[model samples]
Target: MLERNEALKVIHERHSTRMFLETPVADEDVRAILDAANQAPSAHNQQSWRFIVLKGKYKEELADLVLSKAADFPKPSSTLLRLASRSIHSAPVIIAVANTGELIARGGDLFNIKDGSGVDFFRIMEIQSSAAAVQNLLLAATSLGLGTVWLGVLVLIKDDILKFIGEPKGEFMAVIPLGYPGQSSRGPKKKSLEAVIKYFVDE
Candidate 1:
């Protein structure tokens, strides 16, 4: 178990770095982060999460895809686009995580006959489980002196990205860009704990 101070340090220091240095992240460190993600819990151990690691020209292509899609929708800030561009250009790695919808299922031994059930339930579970795993991956990166940013904008161009990454249709939840921080960043602003939390008691 991590000591309280060590855990808190990781949490407090973790930030969504938009600018990254030119240095490339070592392959071993990338493997370590992914391994940490694999350690995340899954529903019925289905482990439905899949990932595509993007770099070089592929990353630039993805950024263009995002920018084009964003233009088609409501006008977002120029600053946001610049930040996204900087992130993609400067970061050494980007991980695209997808959910394999069809893979969730029940299993049984050859000798025993058991009806398969809870596949749908397991799909939902995969989302929650994969999210937790992503969180772990982010924390692990921060602990190792790296930076990360979660981008939900990819969902808008999910189909394009899936095709770009060669992921099968209907499989992916989110994409996260990771690297060393070029510009120090404070995490996003958040509501106070009192405003966001509620407690319930059973009678």
Candidate 2:
């Protein structure tokens, strides 16, 4: 585990990496990142996240799958999908995350939800839990000196991707391309902390 300040530094340094070196990430680092992801807390402790790690030909296959499926879409969307799929080749590894459908059944059992009325709430919980795990993954990669980008666009072809990866029952969360960065980045601009914060107090 990292010290408090070291952890903060890693969090601050993390940024989206779109161009990666051909260099391969170590197997140990990948395992560490996945382990970090597994530690995330889920609603009702469902821990519904599942990960599919891709390498070599699998990366190209997944990208090709996305490219082909995305072609059926209309103008700007197809264009966007094409561009996004191309980015997959920039990294040596891709990790696809999903919500494994455990949350729905468990939440239903806990809340006595037998209809669609509470399904949305459970779905949202699943997404939130998966997202937390992804954040942990990103941070873990950053701490290990590896680069990563959270590629949520892949979810547009979620069903196809899940089927390709043999997780037909899961809900796609994000696809992360990981490797050593081919280029340096300072990260994108952001609103000032003050601008995005609000506090309330009694007078």
Candidate 3:
């Protein structure tokens, strides 16, 4: 278990890193992050997350595709694009998280649920499970002294991304670009916890 101060430091220092250095994330580090992700709790112990690591030429292609799609949409300021461009060029790796939508049976019993019902339940579980895994991955990266950013801008162009990654239909959830942060990425301002959280209790 991590000490409280260590945990707090990771949480506080973790920010979306856009600009990155050209250093590649080591295979062992990637495995460690994935292992941490696997440790995330899932409903009924259904762990249904798939990840594709893109590096080298593949990463460059993904960045190009993303920028092409961005050009077609309403966008943030040109400054943002310039920053994203630099980030893509500098980062050495990108990871695409995907979902298989496979139903995980409780125990060895697979015939307990109705046919379609199992799939429906699994779909919902996959989304929740994968999200938790992603959080774990990000936190793990921070713990390893690496930086990561969750890019939602390109998520809207899901179909294009899926095609670019050669993912068959119904296999992916989202793509996350991972790497070392360059000196330029200023983390975005976050809302205060008081403004975003609410508590109610009865004694």
Highest TM-score model number: 2
Higher-ranked by lDDT: 1 or 2: 2
Which model is ahead, 1 or 3, in terms of TM-score?
A: 1
Tens-place lDDT per residue, model 1, 61-85, is 8787766666555546544554565
TM-score of 1: 0.82
lDDT of 1 at 61: 85
User: What ordering of candidates by lDDT runs from best to worst?
Assistant: 2, 1, 3
Instruction: List model 3 lDDT by residue over 3-42, tens digit each.
Output: 4798787877788887777788899998898899889887
TM-score, each model? 0.82, 0.93, 0.80
Q: List the candidates ranked by TM-score, beginning with the highest.
A: 2, 1, 3
What is the number of backbone collisions in each predicted candidate, taken in the order shown?
Answer: 2, 0, 1
**Candidate 2 at 37: error in angstroms?**
0.8
Best by lDDT: 2
Candidate 3's C-alpha lDDT?
Answer: 0.72
Worst 10 residues of 2 by lDDT: 1-10
